[model samples]
Target: MRCGIQSFFFLTLGGAETLLLTSMAYDCYVAICRPLHCHVRMGRRLCVLMVTGSWVMGSINSCALSIPYCQFRAINHFFCDVPTMVTLACMDTRVYDYMVFLSTILFFVLPLFGIVCSYSQVLLVVYRMSSAEGRWKTYSTCSAHLTVVTFYYSPFTYTYLQL
Candidate 1:
């Protein structure tokens, strides 16, 4: 069904977004907390692997849910959300709903939690620095990262969570 295919695309997009935010936070943590080893820890190969893994996970999650929704054609939301689209199906959607709910928790909520935790620890370390130069440098780096995270997340949260 067209709705199922659209749902797959949107779910993959959402999963990839969540993974990207999580990876960015992890990169920042290494850059700030272990600056000496950042180059070693976040090498090109590792970066590529992380990105590839995220896409693989996103694709798997998307396909797993979308495959079941082939019976449905209508989707209620302006955008494709698996649960919402599944609700429009004429057939039973309990299993599909459960899968979507689980995938959301794993791909979205858990990654967000990790990102928040990583940033909190990074901020705590920044706050404890005594020297003016150290403080300024740390603050500068953190402010940039925070600005980016806020810019990306605020609108998404406002649109999805509030709605």
Candidate 2:
């Protein structure tokens, strides 16, 4: 039961936070790459829908992941997570590990990819500008968010991939 709760918490919270970061990346992409269309393309309605969808996705994912850990089991690692829990399970966990990897790719890797692509485009756009000041000015907007992404995604990727 405790393991189940842990998986549930990780899935729900992790998914939401990951998706929120993805959304912010999209915001930066749209803002920098397509300023004119940003307002029209990403309105209040879309933002709300994206946020609601993230919560729904997180809950659904949590439910899916929690079911597998229904029975109590020992966790091998310091934390209660799918990877550690899988390692601790008596049953063969090769299949579960693959599933977790796939889910991690979906929940984590894809978002990181989107963030990379977003920043890449932002870079291209800034480079296309004539003045160095313009480039610096554009990059300044995203630097803070990018810093946060670096700190957040590095450990996350290490955690999932290392597991």
Candidate 3:
């Protein structure tokens, strides 16, 4: 019971964080790529709704995933999770594995791809600017976002996708 509950919490947190990162990357892209319309596009109501929707989706996904593992209690690792739960459970996990792969694509791969594309467009726009000081300023702003993104994703990719 405890393992299942804790795993549920972790799943919810992971899903929420993934969505939050995706939203933040989009927000960054808009703020930099469309400075003129950013205010209108990223209004307070929209921001609030994005956050609320992230949490709601995260919660729903967690519920849908964890509800089935209630009876399976033997956690293989130090924590509860879909992988560990699937391994511990005595049933066919092919569907669960597929869901996990699809979620990884939706939540991790897509967001990372969008973040890269958004920043690439931002870079192209910044590159075309003639003002040295303005270009430097814009590049510096993107540096912070890129830094965090690189650090966050590099290890994740290495850990999961290594050959």
Candidate 4:
């Protein structure tokens, strides 16, 4: 019970972070690639919807943590996560393991792909800018976003996709 709760929250928070980063990447794409339409494309309602969607997807991913486990009481890791929980399972957890993998792909990998595509478009726009000032500004904005994505996703994907 305790492990399930811990894993659920951990996975949920991780999912939210991933989706939020993806959404930020998309925002950058719209701002840089379609500056005129960025306001309309990323309106207040759209921002709200994106946040809600992130949390919903996170909750769905965490739902896979509810598998039967052995009588083990200690988690090897600092916190209870899917990998640690899997190690505690007495039954064959291949299916659950696969589910975790699929969830990682869905919640982590797909968003990463989207982020890459978004930045690619942003880069193309930045490349064609008439003013060096504008180009530098765009690059500065994107570099910060990319840095955050790298710092957050590096450990996240490492932890979840190791399965």
Candidate 5:
């Protein structure tokens, strides 16, 4: 159905966006926390791998969620949310729901956890710095990243968990 296809498109786009943000966060983490080894740690090959993984994951998730919706034709929301559309289906959707849950855990929850852990470690090291200047510099570098992380994660959490 058109609605099903549209939903797949948007979810794919959203997933890709999340992946992009996550990759950027990883880059920032390396740059700030491992300045001397940034080049070696984030080489072109690794960057390519990260990006390819993101897209592949996003595509696979989108396809997995979309394939089961061949039975459903209507979409209630303004955007195509695979979960919502799955709920509207007349046929059994237990398997589809389970897959969506798994994908959500994999794509969103796990990445969020990684980002939090990475930032926590970075903060700990920054706070342990002996020099005030070093602390300030580290904090300054991390502040922007933290702000963006908060902005991205807050809404994502609210949407997926709280709300």
Candidate 6:
């Protein structure tokens, strides 16, 4: 039961955070790419929908990853995540590992791609801006967000992708 709860918490939290970051990337895209439409595009309704969708996606991910475990419970990792749980299980876990990898691609790699695309457009716009101050401000805003994203995703990628 504890392992189950841990899996639920870890997967749900990771997915929610990932999707929230993607939503923020979209917010940035709209703000920079469509400044005039920012008010309309990112209004209260849209923000709420984005946040709700993130949580829903997280829940769905956790549900989809609900693989039954065996009697053994010798968890060697700090957290009770999918990989560690699979390792501790008595049965073969190759198929489950593949599923985790596919989910990672869906939840992490795809969002990172979207973020990169958004930032690429933002970069183009900032490059074309006439005011030096505007360019600096945009760069500073994006740099801080990117730094936080790097800190969040790097360890996750390393932990999940490594053999």
Best-matching candidate per TM-score: 4
- Model 1 Cα shift for residue 63 (angstroms): 4.5
Candidate 2: where is the Cα deviation over 4 Å? 44-49, 52-78
* Superposed model 6: Cα runs more than 4 Å off: 43-70
CA lDDT, every model vs. true structure:
0.68, 0.74, 0.67, 0.78, 0.70, 0.76
Every model: Cα RMSD to truth: 3.3, 2.9, 3.1, 2.1, 2.8, 2.5
Q: Could you give candidate 4's per-residue lDDT for residues 1-163 as a string of tens digits? A: 6666666677667767877898899999988788799778877887787677667655665554666655756766787677667767788878877877777777788999999999998888888889999999999989998999999988876776654
- Tell me how far the alpha carbon of residue 5 in candidate 1 is from the true structure, in angstroms, after superposition: 3.5
Ordered from best to worst lDDT, the candidate numbers read 4, 6, 2, 5, 1, 3
Return the TM-score for candidate 5, rounded to 2 decimals. 0.81
Residue 148, model 6: lDDT of 78
After superposition, candidate 4 runs with Cα above 4 Å error? 43-49, 63-65
For residues 1-163, could you state the per-residue lDDT of candidate 5 as single tens digits?
Answer: 5654665566666666666666666776787678788778767887676667566655555543445544526565677666666676666878877877778788788878777777777877777788999889878877887787788778877766666
lDDT of 1 by residue, 79-145 (tens): 6665465556566767766765666566666877888998988888888887889878877877776
lDDT of 6 by residue, 1-163 (tens): 6766677777767777887787788788888889889878777886677567566545644543456656645777786776676666666677877877777787788989998899899999999999999999988878878887899989987887773
Which structure is stronger by lDDT: 1 or 5? 5
Lowest-sum lDDT 10-residue window in model 5: 63-72
The C-alpha TM-scores of every prediction are: 0.75, 0.81, 0.78, 0.87, 0.81, 0.84
lDDT of 3 by residue, 77-144 (tens): 76655555566556677877677666666667887887878888888888888899988988787788
Better of 2 and 3 by lDDT: 2
After superposing candidate 3 on the true structure, give the runs of residues whose Cα lies further than 4 Å from its correct spot. 60-78, 159-163
Q: Which candidate model has the greater TM-score, 1 or 2?
A: 2
lDDT of 3 at 85: 58
Query: Which is the better candidate, 4 or 6, if ranked by lDDT?
Result: 4
Question: RMSD in Å for candidate 4, one decimal?
Answer: 2.1
What lDDT, from 0 to 1, does candidate 5 have? 0.70
